[model samples]
Target: MRKPRDYDSELKALELKARQLKSRRQSQLGELVIATGADALTSEELAGALLAAVTTHDHAMKEAWRKRGAGFFSGGRPGAGDSAGREPGGAASGAGSTPPPSSEPGAA
Candidate 1:
């Protein structure tokens, strides 16, 4: 006869894997924020901007944003022509500043 499977252990393992994946995603997001210099924004500003992005229904705008994000990953930061993260008529913000220390333990 074949051995019986331990369903409870399998379920627990699956849940643990899900939690690990979620944790990794959150860490990557935090890294992305820092890498993009968005960490300079206050918590309220960041939250509001993220909310706006989430709620926006404009596909073209979303595509633009997506392309810009792809540039960040493929190239370095956005180019001089890119205006997404700049202040109006001003030099790029957060250009040469050090990012604040991360609160998470073991974060570099």
Candidate 2:
């Protein structure tokens, strides 16, 4: 005969796993914010900027923004573009700075 399943223990284990995943996600987001130098802005400013990006539909503008974002993540300076009118020292200032400390307590 097969052994009975411990449903209560299984449920608790699943909940714990979910909590761990959530914590990891928050930690990663915090790191991303600092890495992008977005921590300089207030939450409202960040939300507004993201909302604007989400709502924007200009193909050329979006393409340019995408390139800038790709460059930012690839260890290249932002706005180091061939075109004109880009910000002088926008995201690049923070991109090369030291990474922020981890948010997790007791992290080395």
Candidate 3:
């Protein structure tokens, strides 16, 4: 008769692999944030921006972003007018000139 499979060990191995993959994904996302110069934003601002992007229903805006992202991955310079023909605040904005939120009094 064939030996029974070690389901418990296989399950544990799969769980470990999942955790490792998740960690790698998070790291890559952090790197991408830095690469895109979005690291300048505070955590709150970043989260808000991501939430907006995720919740947006504008197909045209999403498509423009997708094309810009494709250009970025295909060796295009970051913020180099790759988003020409996009909305006014697109590519040329270059990571935004607005200062990050400050904690100090009268900072604004």
TM-score of each: 0.74, 0.62, 0.71
Candidate 1 wrongly placed segments (more than 4 Å): 76-92, 96-108
Residues 2-96 of candidate 2 have per-residue lDDT tens digits of 99999999999999999999999999989877766777677898899889999999999999989877877777753333222356545453443
The order by descending lDDT is: 3, 1, 2
**Candidate 3 residue lDDT tens string, 19-106:** 9999999999988987676776688988999999999999999998898788888887555344544645444344452233233435
lDDT (Cα, tens digit) per residue for candidate 1, span 10-75:
999999999999999999999887767676678998899999999999999999989878877887
- Please give the distance, in angstroms, between residue 64's alpha carbon in candidate 3 and its true position after superposition: 0.4
The clash count for each model shown is 0, 0, 0
Judge candidate 3 against the unseen true structure and give its global Cα lDDT, from 0 to 1.
0.74
Which residue pairs of candidate 3 clash?
Answer: none
Give the TM-score (vs. native) of candidate 2. Answer: 0.62
Compared with the true structure, all predictions reach lDDT values of 0.72, 0.71, 0.74
